[model samples]
Target chain A: MTGPLQQVLGKAAEFGGTALAKLQHTHVPGVGQASTTEPREVAAARWRAVTVFRDDLAGPFPELEALGPDLEVRMQPAPGDRGTELSARFHGTPTDEQVGELRAALRRTKQLAEVGEVLRVDPQPHGTRKATLQGAALEGAAARAPKEGVL
Target chain B: MKAAIWAGVNEVAVEEVDEPQLLNDHDVILKISKTVTCGSDLHLIGGYIPAMRAGDVLGHEFTGTVVERGKAVTKVQVGDRVVVPSFIACGHCWYCSQELYSLCDNGNPNPGITEGLWGQSPGGCFGYSHAMGGFAGSHAEYMRVPYADVGCFVVPDAVSDTRALFASDSVTTGWTGAHLGGTKPGDVVAVWGAGAVGQMAARAAILLGAEQVVVIDRLPERLAQVRQHIGAEAVDYSTTDVVAELRERTGGRGPDVCIEAVGMEAHSTGIQGAFDQVKQQLRLQTDRPSAVREAIRACRKGGSVFVLGVFAGPVDKFPLGAAMNKGLTVRGAQQHGQRYVPEILAHMESGALTTEHLATHTMPLSQAAEGYRIFKEKEDGCVRTVFEPGG
Candidate 1:
């Protein structure tokens, strides 16, 4: 049975995977090897994901509300576009819970991308593929969350 | 030679004041080479400081040559160029031995006051009031220096008279202000006032690694000097709203440290001005709370506000509640010359701190009255006026 912290991490990793896939298509410039042919759809999805994520994190998060207005979080292309980036600027006081969640999400996102490579099997059924992706995302998230009863 | 005698309120004359003769076993009689009129002297002349009389020789900060010394005086011999610390502290006293000479219990000549720290009758000062031990001041051609071995420091050969003269008081005071204020690397510091001490404080702040320094003052030339030469952001409090401007510049948090270098008699227009003047007249207000108010308002929460300026009377309406709410710390005292003078001299020797720029006027001691008038009026960019008493 997964705990609440695990559950949050799992959801965050799934978001990371979807965001990473879209990021690869819009950003990865090299031809053939692993490129998205449908540029318009990829761009639209990237925009939608970024907008949604930004809005979700923009409002007063009870954990980070005290860190003041200097708190800034944004998504950017990782230095070698193969990875995604999440940057946060903290100025004032912030709770331990807020800091922990932010760190966990960032770490889990990177782990999900690493595990996605192993599950890239060819011609799998769409339902099976979705399940595999969900399993990999859950495993990544679980690994990043702190142990139960520990910070 | 006659000395200018301070008889009463607005009454001073070049009268035949007694020439100082060595009284103590460790005393040295100095032929005053240069004696700069200080802002505090104005308070004495205006009859603000009680116990001042007709014959009180009046200058505290000066450099001179030791013309004569008692048999016990060994460290500084006759004819040596020396700069006297404002206070006469016995070298062997517990406080002087600890380098906290300003609080020396044995050094102060007055028996009524418990040390010279505060609220006590003034300790003995050169040319200050009778309450301050009635010691003759440096304003005359020749004056006596007690505790010559401890109170006088040898001026290094490398430092010029024009630059090194302020080492006696203003420069050391400024250094002490910034040092005690906890000025550190990458600190956003705002210094109030662009007078000699204020400029020195800004310079010290920069040397101590304040990443951003802001100097606030009314005079344009002083402000310009602070901006261009001292490398600080100059704010004209005359025109700009200082509290709001500082907040905006410091990301709505305000400076990490604010220094009230303006001292007791900062004349600003409006409600603050009325309060300051009233406080001065009342004698209940010693610390300039207006400057303190501005410093408190302009400091980031948990920052420090340093009061280097002199306050004569009691302080009314201190914002202790606001200071507590903000978790801010405030600390100030008279300069500890013994602690910092050697280091300041070292810096001067190394060419790191040059005070020549602050000395805007240099005249013979005969023109001392005019120099005082100009300094009081703060006219024509007169930041520091050095008087050559020998001339």
Candidate 2:
């Protein structure tokens, strides 16, 4: 029974991640992503970027560089002394999972360059999770959070 | 370890939970001394925020002794008594450099949830919700604090835990409103809602050299507290017209600054109140925002209005036209506690700021559910209930 439950939760976590990705692209009436719905190729073709606070950001950013040889990475000084703008995109259209990896890599690059260590929250503490479906879904959403966002 | 958990919507319970551990190089573990229920926590408790999961820990404002430290934590040592801001921020972020710690880009790990609701996400808050950060709250006996050197401030030796605890959220949040609302010397400031945050806002205005500060609230107990503890004039909005009264007191020019400390669930007496309640219940609007409406209407032309409240989403009848036509500089943000904690501690040390009055009830962690109950219902004049997790 425990094995089955774990398997179900694992699947739920995957679903949660996919749902979040869809949520970003989906248009809601009053609120949603700033961009309108676009072709998948158009969405994936755009460069994803985050600005690091260090003005002297010269990157051998291990996180983004690790993606592959096909990934195009760029760095430039941001305006008004904000710091460096680091951006990346694949040579061709990438899968949702690939986009998710890029997002996570960009965030980690910023964290590592600025704070020197990525912040962590898990293995902290919690009361008993009641094994409810919504609880599992939320757990899944949180697991995918490092990779999902406007960035 | 015993901690308060959000059992369900409008439900809280005390449960034995796993103790926290240092999860990162910059993290520190705290033996929580005192953790208090905040008005903002009510939104999470009532399912208004919609990100809270059952069994999630419930607290943000707390004072504690650092019991353990990670390698990267240097500013605070083990056994140092400290108060952490509700928001989690890495000191290295651009927003943190700008002293806008609440808008730190790296704080909220679960940005997708918030970015989906709000166009952009702010910093993470403890025990608020997963959308802010799934970080466990301070209600437990021991809790982990990330970015210790950035977020934790040592409580001054002269300040007791009870007095210093409010600095974690209320005083800092209030200071954010008064300071950013641009209250200058000789300015007349009007603060709506005399809850802990509202009272603190009014007090901050006074300390910032506001010529006159008035706090408006419907609750007699909170209003009286504003007068007695905060040393600010109190108005019973239930009994009087708030805008007219503020205008009258400000010599018909209206207040130079208006701060709305009442969040989504603002109370009003007449048709507007009924309409807001109905709309909220019917899911037509996510927030009530009656105090905001009043603040904008009452603010002097070209004056400033700052919202310190924790509103989740859009409200009906917002009076944006009044805000625009009046040329009001309207701004709102979560409390940037990191920017103001040092000054607040200094004020606390000097006995210039008194916050012990806000902790009207103190009890063991076992009573947190009941504590939240009395606080939410405003029963027995309970302003805030401080829970001693160690006890």
Candidate 3:
């Protein structure tokens, strides 16, 4: 019985020591450091098309009460050499399908850039989205685009 | 032993009382050498604070010589000259460890809640109301101080009691305001009220390198002192539209920081005007906003407002929308006297902060009641009245 009890106490001490070490490692000194690769780089690689939508439809799309009845919606897409940029404004919400259609239109307009995926989507409260499209063959396609209204 | 007692609102008397004895290992018996009445004492005398009884002691700010110490007391020895912080604190509690000594968990006389001040209720206070800890005040010949090691400060032999007295409350309170407001070099700071605390706030602002300091008050004498002694511009709220005047002086932007030194007793005629304006436009009633309203409105966008005043009950109809829209931050706490007294004493030693101008009246302990009366009536240009108990 004494041998078994001694083993249990030894295990408890080891567990406590390990837990304290992990806590000290994670919480002390270097807790706030960030990795080197910028968030924009990852965003550019994931999105092939840009989509602009109203603020209310930025979350899950296509619900009856999402957009109020009185809102007026407008979509404006500007053509760019590398990819097309889309901007939208509305008094209320918009459907997800409407946002998807805008992305398709942008992809077709920028045929020189092979649209790989939707790399970024930013929803502004005043109804705007700035998205970056990625291409498999083209390196630094995002950096080459002109900076203008993309959302 | 003789003690200063309050007979009724605005009435005070001195009478013989029982001498204090140490009840715990942490207690010490102090023979008070000096004591002074605080403005908060008026709250009790005027019945604004409930639970005050006849023959209760009336002083909170004091300094004394310790005649005896409990067995557990280690920091201070007998015959030590100590300046006692107004609030008692236990050094071991989380609040005390963080230097928020006023909120010490183990310090308050009432164990379960925040009420103990010195003598009155579990929120005991020395010589104030029963709602505060009911500990007898230092106005007496002898008094008991609990947790003596934690709350008492040894006065440097070079410092006079008159100059070091304010380290108990007002000076530290002013420093707390400036510290919390984040006053920095080139910031424009405005302090509302010209009381001793307000004057100290202006001084702290100057010390912190505020480019301009504006002090607002209606008293001509106080305003003059603010200008001559505190070296801050004075605004007489009685004659001047304070908000408009401040904005005009600050190049169309309000003060970068505003300190509300007046607290809950702030009275203003602008409440009716604000209410009328809101009623005509938004159909809102704002007739009851305090002077803090003006301070909030006069603060620049993204500025800070430090409230150093004592207030009771819920604040009514504050401008939440304006604070949010302008990104203004409001912060307030009771003065942590224990934490700031040492620094204030150093400033005093260096001749950097002069409190002599604030001591407009001084008298012996025999005339203590009259001192209270003079200060209460604001007679003889009294800003602060100090009583030399041993004199």
Best candidate, lDDT-wise? 2
TM-score of chain B of 2: 0.99
Q: Is the docking of candidate 1 incorrect, acceptable, medium or high quality?
A: incorrect
Superposed by TM-score, candidate 3 places the C-alpha of residue A50 at a distance from the truth, in angstroms, of 55
Q: Model 3, residue B140: displacement in angstroms?
A: 1.9
Q: Tell me which of candidates 1 and 3 scores higher on lDDT.
A: 1
Candidate 1 lDDT by residue in tens digits, A32-132: 12243554433222211111112112333333334446566566554433233445544444443444444333323322232211111111101111223
Worst 10 residues of 2 chain A by lDDT: A26-35
Q: Is candidate 2 or candidate 3 better by lDDT?
A: 2
Preferred candidate (DockQ higher): 2 or 3: 2
Which 10 residues in a row give candidate 2 chain B its minimum summed lDDT?
A: B111-120
Measured against the true two-chain complex, the DockQ scores of the candidates, in the order shown, are: 0.00, 0.70, 0.01
TM-score of chain B of 1: 0.92
**What does the lDDT come to for candidate 3?**
0.63
Pick by TM-score: which candidate is best? 2
Provide TM-scores for the models. 0.68, 0.97, 0.66
| Chain A fold similarity by TM-score, each prediction | 0.26, 0.90, 0.20
- Tens digits of per-residue lDDT for model 1, B1-391: 5454564566544445456666666788888777777777777777665545444556788888899997768898898888887866655433454576665533443322221123222224567654455566777777788777777788899888766777887778788888889999999989998887888788889888999889999999899888766788899888999999999998898888888887666667688779778877775554455777788877899999998876654566668887899999898767777678888888888988887877788887666667777877789888767777667
